[model samples]
Target: MHPARRSAGWMQTRFFVMKKKLLSLILTGLGILVLPNAALGAEPKTIGELVTKISNALYSAMSGIVLIAWIVIAFLYLTAWGSPEKLKTAHHAVIWAAVGTAILVLYKSIEPIIKNALGV
Candidate 1:
């Protein structure tokens, strides 16, 4: 492989891994923050409990989605590097999708906080 292309590939892999780690960390933190303390008060079979269970499941799924996105983005980036236009498009899509995923995860993680904040 050409030296320049090799270096770009290495950089892309490293960058994608770093981004994935950072995103995961942030999501974990949000998970910690938004989880309710209902264990101290609410019953296990109550609606609150059911909602919490659903939220936990959604979080798990989003976590998987983020992991898959990282893999797909990494592949797209590595292949598209040879073509500036394609690489640009792939990078843009990856970043935007990641951002949207973050927002959705954040919302799901902190839905209670949101409701309280808005007095809903």
Candidate 2:
């Protein structure tokens, strides 16, 4: 009826769509990452085992995602057509992705020491 009310309804619909898309993307990524372990028959029978399996799967998935993000950032930077906003976004993406990858690598490297200490 009113223009302002109509615009607000449209904005709400757009927000819902974006939220749904993000949720689907996350679910698909998790399914893709977990399918390999499922096919390999790494079924967890206990809560601790499930936690470890999920942790390992998440690390592996994050490693792949970080690598892909770096590649995407590189492409973004190269094909930015001299756009300042695009370059800035790409730069930020690269910095955050690199930091995430480094943290994951550090955790993996120290995982053995942690396991030894815990005697798991």
List pairs with backbone clashes in candidate 1: none
lDDT of 2 by residue, 1-120 (tens): 999999878976886686678657766876787678667666777655665676677787776677667756766786576999999999899889889888988866665565566666
Q: Pick the candidate with the highest TM-score.
A: 2
Question: What TM-score does candidate 1 get on C-alpha atoms?
Answer: 0.52
Candidate 1, 1-120: lDDT as tens digits = 899999988998897888799778866755654454423454557556656666665665566566666766776786684898989978887887789687766767596874466554
Model 2: which ten-residue window has the lowest total lDDT? 109-118
Residue 115 of model 1, lDDT score: 46
- Pairs that collide in candidate 2 are none
**TM-score of each model, in listed order:** 0.52, 0.55
Q: Where is model 1 more than 4 Å wrong at Cα?
A: 1-44, 114-120
After TM-score superposition, the amount by which residue 14's alpha carbon in candidate 2 deviates from its true location, in angstroms, is: 22
Candidate 1 Cα deviation (angstroms), residue 44:
5.3
lDDT of 1: 0.69
